[model samples]
Target: MPEIMSDTPTDFKHFIRIIGRGQRAGRTLTMQEAEQAMSMVINGQATAEQKGAFLMLLRVREETAEELAGFSQAFRTCSLASVADLSVDLDMGCYAGKRRHLPWFLLAVMLLAKNGKRIFLHGTHEPDSKRLYLKEVLPQIGFKVAQHPEQVQVALDTFGFAYMDLKQINPQLDDIIQLREQFGLRSCANTLARMLNPSHAAHCLQGIFHRKIDEKHRETAALLNDANVLCFRGEGGEVEFNPLRDVTLHVSRNGQQSSEDVTATCETFITKPQELDAKQLISVWTGEFDDIYANHAVVGTLSLMLVLVDKLDWTEAYQQAEQMWQGRDKKWPVVLPEDKSEVVPFDTTGKHYAH
Candidate 1:
C-alpha cells in the first residue's frame, strides 16, 4: 500500500510505506511518521528494498524522542556543512569505527589543540574491514588529513586542529559507505553520521553506542539551535576510556538536556588496561598487544577532555584526572599514534547496539 505521496508523504516509497506500516503493526512512528520516514531516507527516495525495511524497522522497536527528533530533522535538511561558529566551534569524535581502543579522540584533539581550542574532526577511512581511523590515527598523531574543503578551513584556521576526511568532506555522504555494508546493520546513515556538524559546534562532544540514541541526540541538538550538546554512552562505541566506570555522560546544555552516572567519577581516575578483554582490546590495538592499552586510552582521553571543557568541575574533573595520570609520561608524544601501528587495543567484547 505505497502510493501516498502528495497529500503530505513526499515519496521515498511514500515514506517507506509509512515506516513499513509502523514496523509491521507493532507501531510507533508518528512524529509526523518520523519526519516522513526521515524525509524518505534523506531525500534519495528510499528503495534499496525501502532502505532495508526502514533499517530493520528502526532496529527493532527503538527510536523515540519524537522519533529521534524526526530523524534529526530529516538529517539537518540534507546537510553538507554550514553550522559554523557555535562560539569557537568544538566538535569531538567517534561516530563509530574503531571497535576496540586507541582513539582517545585523537588525544582529545591534541589536548584541544594545545589549548587554544578550535578542533573539527570527521571520519571515514580504514573502511573495507575497519580498525585504525581518525583518518589513520590523525596522520599518526601530527594531524594532517585535510586534503580539501579548503584544507578543512586551513586546518581550522592554522592548526587549532581540523581533519575532515569523510571521503573529502562529503562525497554524497561518502557514497553511503556501500549502504553501510549493505545493512549488515547501522543506518539512518549511522545516525546521520553523527549529525555532521562541520564546526557548527555550539560546543558539541558526541559519542554514541546507544541509550536509545540519547533521544536522537537531544532532538538533534534541539533542532540545531545547538548551544552546547554532549551525548554519551561510549567506549566500544568508540571515544573510549572508562576503566571499570564513569563513562556514560550525556548532556545537551544551552539546548538543555541531561543524563548522568559517569562510572563513579570515571572509576576514580584510571588503571586497568593491560589486556582487558575483547580479544585483548584487539591485541593491544594491533601491535599485537601491550602498550598498556594505549596508555590507558590516553589517560582516559585527558580525563574526558577535562569533563568536556568545564576545565575540571566533576570533583575537579577527578582532581585534574589525577594530574592526567601522573603527567602521562610527558603526554607521551601527545597521546601516541604517529604510526605506532595506529594505537589499537579496544575489543571489549563488542555488541552494545541501540540506535
Candidate 2:
C-alpha cells in the first residue's frame, strides 16, 4: 500500500505520482485521496508536471460517483461562503454551447426573476477557444457578475438574476484552469466545474454534452440529498433550442425522475435555412422561431424552478412563459460579427462588461 500522507501534500509532484499510479494499475482513488489530490491542485501547491498528470488521468477515465461526491464536498469546504439565510431555489449552470445560439439561459433567468423566483447563474469564460459565454454576455443583457456570495444574494433579491464567476467566487478553483489546458482535453474538471453549486441551492439546471455524464450527474446530485437536479444533453452543451430537432429534457426532481421528448416536428416550428440560402441560421434563433420552442425551454426551466417553489404547476408555468414571450416586442440580442467589432481582447485584469 502506498502510504497516505498525514499532512496534505503541498505540491503537484506528489499528486501526479499518486494519481498516475492509480490510473496505471486500473484503480480508483478513495474519496479522501481524490479530495486531497484536488485540493492540492486547487490550492496551487502542485507542480506543473503533477498538474498535467492529474488532469490527464481524470481525462482518460471519468471520476467515480463517490470520488465526485467527495470532490464536491471538499470544494464546498474550501470555497463558498455560508449564506444560510438566502434561499436559492434554482441554480442554473449554463455552459457555452457549441453553436453559439442566442443565450436563452439569460432570457429564462430574466423571466424566472420577473415571476419572483430566486435564481443563481454560475459559470466561467476561459479557454475562449470558441462560442460566447454567459460570463461575456450577461452584461449585454443588463446584469453584472457578483463579486461575493453576499452580492449574489443581494443581486438575486433585487434583479431576479445573479451571475457568479467561478474565478471570483472561488479563486482556488479558478487557478486550475491554466493547468487544465495543459492536458488539451476536457477532463472531469470541466464536468465537475459545472456541478459546483456555491449557493447550496437545492435545485439545479445542468446542461451537458455526453449522455453518460447525465446519469452520473443525477447520482452526484442525489448524493448531495438536498439537490433536485435537471440534467439536459443541451443543444451543443448550452440551453438553446436545437434548430435541427426537438430538445431532449431529462429531469430529476424531488427524488423522482422523468424525461420529456420535445422534438420540433411542427412545420410552423421548423424552418429549412439552407434552402432559403440563409448565410447563417442566426436570424431564426434571434427572431421568432416558434412559440413551442420558447415555451418548451421556459417550461423546462420552470419545471426545475417549480421543484424549488411548491406553488407552481407545469401547465400554469408553461402558460406564464408563453405570455412573457408574446409580450416581448423585439428580438433578443443575438451576437453577430458586428458585435465583436468593439470587443477588446479578454483582459485578465480589466473589469468584465456583459456585452
Candidate 3:
C-alpha cells in the first residue's frame, strides 16, 4: 500500500496499520474493533484509499466470523431502516448474480410470497456484472423495484415481497462495494452485505461463492443471535443449489447452529441445463417449458425454505414444494402495476439431522 500521507485522518488510519502489518504481525480485528473500523467507513470518516486498503487487506488475510459480524453491525447502524418495523418472514440477500443458469430460486420466492410469506429481497445489479441479475428478470415476473425506502412497506403489504438495491438501503456500503472496480477483487463488503438482517426478520438465507467462508457466515449469524438462518455454498454464489452437486448447509435455529450435509439427488433430476435466459424462469413457472434442472432448482430451494419456516422434514417439504409448484397462481402477476413497488447468517458443524 502507498505510504499513508501525513494528512491521513486518524479516525481510520490506525485500523489500516493494524491489519496491514504483514502476515506475522497483522492479526484479525476483534468484533468491536472491526465494528469501529467499519463505522468510520460508513460515516464518511475514512478516506477512499483507507477503505480500499482496509478491505483488500482483509480480503488477502480472509475475514473472520467476528469481523463479518462487526462489519454488518456497523453498516446497519446507519442503514435506511424504513422497513425495520415490518413483520417480515424472510430476509433474502442476493448480491451474487448467476453465470451458469437462470436464478430459479426466484420462482421459489414468488411462490412463498404468493402463499403469504412477507419476504424482503435486497441486492444489487451492477452495470458491469457479466452474470445475469434477478432485477432484470423481476419485471418479466411482475415484480417492482421500490424506488424509495418507504415504498418497501407498500410492496410487501400489497405483493408479499419487495426489493431494494444496496444504494437505496445504504449507499456507503454500495460505494465501498463498487471499489471492487478499483481493487480488481471483491472485499468483505460482499459477505457482510449478505449478513445484514436489516429488519430482524424471522428467518434469513445466505449464499456464498467460496466454501471456506460458509462457516464464517454461520458463526456470524450465531454471533448476532440470528433467530434462524441457512448458509451454504450456492450456485454461482447465489442462494440457489446445484441439485446435481452435494451441498452442506449450515443452519442456525433459535441461536443453535448445526450443519446438514445434503446428498445429491439422482443425476437425472436436473440435467442438461439450457443456455442462460431469464425468460426460462418465467416459462418454467408458467408450465410452458420443461427443464428438469430448473424444476429441481425451484422445488428444492422452495422445499428447503419450507423446512426452515414450517420446520417440516425434507420429504414432506419436497412434497409441499412440489404441490406449491403445481398449484401456483398460474395466471397471476398478469401485468405490471403502474405504481412503484419499491424495487427491490450462521455457522454450524458437520452433523446430519434426519429428514
Candidate 4:
C-alpha cells in the first residue's frame, strides 16, 4: 500500500489509488477530491508519471458532471483571474481543429464583435498540419492571436473580440493536451479546457464533435452554476454549426435546462468549404465573396448564442444575425505579420484522434 502518513506529500498517490485501481475495483472521486487532484496537477506538485496515470485512468471512464466541474474549478482557481477588467459577454471554446470546413465560425465571431458583443475566444491548435486550426488561420486572415491575458484584454478593447491560446491561460494543462501525440489518445484535458471559462464570462459556448459530449458539456455547465451555456455537435467538432443540417442545441440559461434546434436554412449540402484558403475568411467577411454554406453557418451559430443570452428570440435571433452579418465592417484593421518566417510549421501525419 502507498504510504498515507499525515503531513506527507502523497496526495497524488491517493488520487491515483482512487482512479487507477483495476477497472472494476476503482470508483470515481468525490467533487472535492477531484478538485484537489486537479489542483495538484496544475500546481506542478504531481509527478509526470502520476499525472499520466491519473489522466489516463479518468479517460477510460467518462467524466461525471461533478468531476468536470471540480476539475474546472481547480483550473479557474489557478488561471490568471485579473484581465484588466474588460467587459466580456461570451466565453467561446474552440478546441476541435477544423478539418472539413474553413472555420466559418471565425466570421460569425467577428460579426458579433463588430456588433459590440465582447467575445472571448480561446482554443488550442493541435499540432496537425492536415487540418486548419484557428491559431494558424488567424494570422493569415489579419487577426492577432493573444499570447497572454493582457493582450486578450487589449484585443477585446480594440475589436470587441479576442482569441486566446489555452497554453497562455495554463501551460500545465496545455502540456497535458499535447500528450495526445504521445499517448495516441485524448484525455480529459480537452473537455476540461472547454469549461475553463477563465474569465468567468457569464455565458459560455462550446462545440464538440460527439453528441454524448454535448450532453456532458450541458450538464457540466449546470454543475458550474453558470448563468448561460450553449453546446451542440458543431461542424468539424467546432462551435460552428452546419447550415445544411438541423442542429439541436443543449442549453443552460439562468440555471434552467432547455433544448432548441436551429433548423437547416440552406437548400444545398456542403460537407466542406468551397475553398480552404485562409484569405477567403477575410474575403468572406469583407463581402468580396458570397457563399451560401458559409453565410448560413455564421448566421446559424450567431443565432444560437443570441437566443442563449436572451438577447433575442429564435426567429428574431436569426433575423438579427442575418442583419448583423449583412452589415459587418468590411475594413476592420488587418495587420499582417511583418515576418512570416516565425510561423510554426504543423505536423502533417494526419492521425486525428476523436475530439
Candidate 5:
C-alpha cells in the first residue's frame, strides 16, 4: 500500500502568506508570532523564499513596535553562541559608517572608557560599503581589535572598552544583513541588529537614520523591558549627537510605558570642516588638532550617553562630558607591535568566543 504525503506547507509559509496578503488584507504580526517567525528565520528553519518574502512584505510597511520587540528578542535568544559577559556599562551599536565627516563619536566613547566605563561596541560593514567603518580606522588610532567574545571580555576588564564586528558576534545575522545586495533595500534585519544589546547591559544606545524608526526603536526596548535605552536619529546613522542643530531622541528608563523625549544641547546650526580626513579623528583625540564642530560632536555625544550610563541629568552630563574632554590624555597611546597584551588599545573582530 502506498502512503499518502501530507500537503501542509511549512510553518514559516504561514508568516509569508499573512504578511504578503496584499495591502487591503495584510496585517502585522503579533509580538508572540513575530518572535516565533524571527526564531525560525534565525535558526534556518524557514525556507529561503519564505525568509525573503516575509522580510520584503514587512519592509513594505514599517515594522510595528511589537514586531521590532519580537524580532529583537528572537535574535538575542538565538545568537550564534552565548556571548561573553563583558559586564559592559553600555551597549553601543555602530552599523552605519560615516561619510560626510569623521566619526568624532569614537573620541567620546574612548574618553568614557578612559574614565572607566566599559563599553561593548558592535557593528557591521557591508562588503561594498565605502564609508569609514570602525574596522578600517580604529587601528590607525592605536586601538586593538578583539576577534572573539573572550577578547571583548578581557578588553572590557582591562581597558574598559571593546569592539566587535557583527560578523564575529553572529555570522548568521551578518549574512542576513549582507542581503541588502540582493534585496536592494533594507530588511527588518538591519533595524533589529542594533538592539541586540548582547551583553544585556543596563544601558543601551541605538542610533537610527530614519526618523520614522525612532519611536519604534524606543518602543521595542520598552517592550523588551530594557532597563535604560536611548534611541535617536544619529549623525550619519551612527550614535553621535549632531551638535549643529536641535534634535530629539527618545529615552526609556526601566521600561517605561512611554519613552521621554530628550533634545539636543546645542543650537548652533553650522560649522565648517576645512577638509575631511579620517586621520583627523586621531589628531583631535591627541590634542594635535581642533575642529570646533568635531569637539562639540564628541562632547555632545558623550553627554547623551552619560545620561543613561551614569544616571546624570542632561545639563550635568554635558558639563561633566566637557571636563572629561579636558582631562583626557593629550597624546594617543602607543601599542608596540610586539605587545599583544589586553592593556594595549584594541581594534575590531578577529575571533569571538564565549567566556
Candidate 6:
C-alpha cells in the first residue's frame, strides 16, 4: 500500500519553521497548515510571542492567496454569526477608516440602500486617529452602529443597512489588529478582515490603499471560493471608488479572472483632509449640496455596486446611478429619536466616550 501522511506538526516551533526559516531559507505555509496555525492563534493555543512572530514573518514576505484564504477561513470559523438566512445584498468592509478623504462611499451605500439593497457594513476604527472613522460618522449621518450580532440583525431589519465594528464581530482579531502599535506594521489581519464577509453575502467589494495589493485581494477572494468580489484601490483605502484617479479594478466571479481600468471621469484638485467637509455626505445625499467631484464619486461608486449585483451593465449602471442619485428621497431616516435613558459607550483613542 502507498504511504499516507498526517497533518500533525511536532510543535508550534515546527509550524513556525515552515515560514520563519530565515530570508532565503523560509517557505510559505501550505493552505491546511496556514489554517491550523491561525486557528491556534485565534483559539488561544499559541503564545503571544509566537503569534507576533507568525504575523510579522508573514508581513515580511507579504501574504499569498492560499495563506490569506486559510487565515480568513480560520477567522470565519471563530467569529462569523448566522446572517446566512438574511436577505443581504452586499458585504462592505471599511477597515481603513478615511484619512485623506471623507467617506464619500458612505453616501454610495446609502444610495444603494435607498434603491432597496440590503447591505451590511463592518469595520474597526483603530484608536490611532479620530479622522472620521465610520463608527463616528455613521451616527453623525443618522445610522446606528450595532455592537452585537443580534443587534446587527435588528439594525438590518429596521434600517436597510447596518454597521458592525470588528471588536463586536471578533474581539480576538480586534486585539490582533490593535497590535499595530506594538509591531509598527500591519499584519495579515487587516487583509483577512476585509475579506471576511460575515454575512456571506453573494457579492463583496474591497478598497485598498496600495495599488499593488489589488491583485492580492482578487486572488484571495478566489481562493476563498467567493463567486463575486470586486477589489480596487480606493481614495484612502476605504472601499469607495476614487473619482479623481484612473483605477484598475480586479474582479473575481466564480474563480474566474477579469480586470478593467476605470478612466478618471472627474479631475478635482481636492486631496487634503482640511479641504473636504464631512457634512457634505448628508448635504449631497439630501440633494442640497452640489459638487462635481462628490457627484461623480457617489455615482461612480454606486455604479460599481450595481454592476456587482448584476442590476445593469457598466455604462447603463453609471447612467442609472446618476438617476438614482438625482431622485433620492430626502427622507430615508437619518437620525432616530433619542432617549437619555440608555447609555452607550463610544470608543475614541482607546478612551471611553459614553453618552
Q: Rate the local accuracy (lDDT) of all candidates.
A: 0.57, 0.59, 0.77, 0.77, 0.76, 0.76
lDDT of 5 at 97: 76
Q: Candidate 2: worst 10 consecutive residues by lDDT? A: 272-281
Off by over 4 Å in 3: 1-8, 269-275, 336-355
Q: Which 10 residues in a row give candidate 1 its minimum summed lDDT? A: 274-283
Question: Which TM-score value belongs to model 6?
Answer: 0.88
Query: Which 10-residue window of candidate 6 scores lowest in summed lDDT?
Result: 346-355
TM-score of 1: 0.32
Clashes of 2: 7
Q: Give all TM-scores, in the order shown.
A: 0.32, 0.74, 0.88, 0.89, 0.87, 0.88
Across residues 264-340, which tens digit of lDDT does each residue of candidate 6 receive? 87876854434445456777767676767778888989988987887466788888888988887876465644644
Candidate 6 clashing pairs? 142-334
Q: Candidate 5 overall Cα lDDT vs. reference?
A: 0.76
Top TM-score: which candidate number?
A: 4
Question: Whole-model lDDT for model 1 versus the true structure?
Answer: 0.57
| Backbone clash count, each prediction separately | 13, 7, 12, 0, 14, 1
Writing each residue's lDDT as its tens digit, candidate 5 over 123-148 gives: 88764445567876676656777788
Judging by lDDT against the true structure, name the best candidate: 4
- lDDT per residue for candidate 3 within 193-307, as digits (tens), equals 8888776789998888776678878888898888899888888788887788888888888668888778765488443343555556667877888878887888888877887
lDDT of 6: 0.76
Please give the lDDT score at residue 306 for candidate 5: 89
> What value does the lDDT take at residue 321 in candidate 3?
94
